[model samples]
Target: MDPVKRHLPPLKTSINKYNLHAKKSLGQHFLLDPMINQQIIALAGDIKNKTLVEVGPGPGGLTRALLDSPARCVIGVEVDQRALLLLNELKEYYPERFKIVEHDALKLDLTTLCDSPRQIISNLPYNIGTTLFLGWLKQGAAWDRMTLMFQQEVAERICAAPNTEFYGRLSVIAQWVANCAIVKRIPPGAFSPPPKVYSAVVNVVPKSEQPSPILFKAMETVTAAAFGQRRKMLKGALKTIDGVNLLAKANIDGTRRAETLNISEFDQLARLYAQNNNL
Candidate 1:
């Protein structure tokens, strides 16, 4: 039997019984659109034999979609007590495939959660979306891929190119170690209690070997300083980093703003900083 069709009854009943109202404090927004739910699942691609780790499975909407997929196992880390109750019922219906951990996703150690060749698929809480992505990236080749939903603006920043308004610390950091692409755009209405802004689904596949840690650290420091005062020129903004000598070391036009630099330019600046610090 199709898992979605078989488990639909329990999902509906659990929702009602638990009074699983979306909590604003948790940045909860249940996705009620079945089509969108299935679409996001499809984006996960070739789930067969793959393990999936999902965050914030509010009302088990996306959880249902994952259950219906060919995935070997679906583990959800949910913080909401009401949603956790509903998730427990789903576990009962699909004992072999469903597992719910009642804990904050942000605090969980993803490296210890599942073995390699896993994937993270979630409509993440907006408040912690970027923080979670950064954490996953720092894990250094932990998962096979990440299919995530973020605010449209954040989605653009992840996939943004050089010199674009959306390009900044996020673009540099994400591009340094992974290939990012916006798979699809979902309208605001697709979500229950639709968010004021549109949302987008993004796919991220990490690189085989990431750039030097020293370079990453330098890039973080440089971008933080540059974008922190985005209006200022690169030379002025980067002066805070010792031994930077921005223009002479990076060969970048000092007159240009931070947004004007491409990934390569940032890489050059990072390399320069690292060399200066012997990092």
Candidate 2:
């Protein structure tokens, strides 16, 4: 037996002990397969002593796996009351190695939650997965890397290429800030209660140089307006953000559609937008 990894009760037993049925409202789908956890951490890169952040660790299946890893510390960000009892057991067993932050991952200030050399690895709750991802993208490269689970469709959107059908504002924003890709496709049967849709694991590592808050906000505004009307030409789609002047400043033809523009073109527009706004 691996002495470091405490042999905890099986997920079903513990889950039954805690009466932790998967909650639909919370998008709860507890992962029981240990192999999946290994693949996720592998994609997280070298976590020898890094702080590993797990969001929505319902029933503590993933949590136990993280603590068992060679990581220096594991923090579980959980908001559900019922799961707290189960996770509390983990905190007791791995007192020095485990910590629990009982707050909504979406509302919590993650920068204040952990130190540097941290990576977020979570089977994120479906409803707030994208919101959490967007927030992380906004925060720039605070973390070393992130391996997260999202509905398969959302995963494709994150890693989608320019001019592709899946590409949109999310694709632009995520690609602009980080190196994102779908590392694995997990089946619904992997969870205790199978979800109707398949889930995918995405790995994100922020780019070396990230956009400043001003420039990022500019990108958000421009992308929203541009992709907001996908079929319209840039001159027409970005009209709300002074498209004509913005395109002229960026020295780009205004006849192109949003999906046709790549990351560099978007960056130019964002920089010009920031300058125009006196930001």
Candidate 3:
């Protein structure tokens, strides 16, 4: 079915009416371009029957665009009282389909916000984007897919390959649990108050097979230790943290640097650590 086109009040009007400005302290760089936002919606794929949880819908720019999509419901979770006030207009426009929740995205339990088979689509606030993405990854299959915006460097890191400069703990952790890709890049100009770096939209679909809770923690511990001193060989980097024994058990070479290790090696290290520690 085609998305129903609803005429929304011009986003500018909401900005002026509410005396709104992008709050720097909140890392708010609102996406004001309809074309770009529609591009993000397209990257999210068929949301006709899907619920979308938007992280920070400042002045309802992307929120309005999302409403125009065929998505069954679009829940805009905003922290700023001013932005929530402006979003109330959207709630009135699509009474049943649109809703606003005033909560900090960082601390809010996103899983409780919607029923099963939901997608998280958002132009996330820069301050909390990485933290929120990592949290979702740790939760494992809580949402169907995540189509989210992050600073260019972060997007690269999430999808970076094992041997690249961008590859690190984030790359291993995200890739181990999902198929990640950078679907679109938005220049700084697209935002209300342009951020210093470019922004990109990434799509992450969680893999069916993930490390067990104990094993996942082991992976976190292993990655933290290895990447904490990424310049050093695994042997030297992990020395204080039982690196030699863990690498030997995982069948990984102690001479390799953390950036050189593949995801499978990391998984092995996690498993071995769990086994050795009786986790």
By summed lDDT, which 10 consecutive residues of candidate 2 come out lowest?
2-11
Q: Write model 3 residue lDDT over 1-279, tens digit each, in one string.
A: 432344566789889999889999998998888888888899888788889999999888788788888888998889898888898876887899997889888888888988877999998889889999888898777778999999999999999998898999999999999999999999999988888999999999999986677888988998999999888999999887798998787788999999999998888888887788899
TM-score of 2: 0.97
TM-score of predicted model 3?
Answer: 0.96
Backbone clash pairs for candidate 2 read: none
lDDT of 3: 0.88
**lDDT: which candidate is best?**
2
Count of residue pairs whose backbone atoms collide, per candidate: 0, 0, 0
Off by over 4 Å in 1: 2-4, 7-10
lDDT, candidate 1, 1-279, per-residue tens: 766476457555677899987788888778877788898988877788889999989898888889888898999998888887788877877889898888887888876877867999999999999999988888657888899999999999999998887998999889888999999998888877789999999999888987666667887887898788888887788778852486676677788888988877887888877777788
The collision pairs in model 3 are none
lDDT of 2 by residue, 14-71 (tens): 8889899999999888888988877877877888999998999999878877887899
Best by TM-score: 2
TM-score of 1: 0.94
The TM-score values for the models, in the order shown, are 0.94, 0.97, 0.96
Choose 1 or 2, whichever is better by lDDT.
2
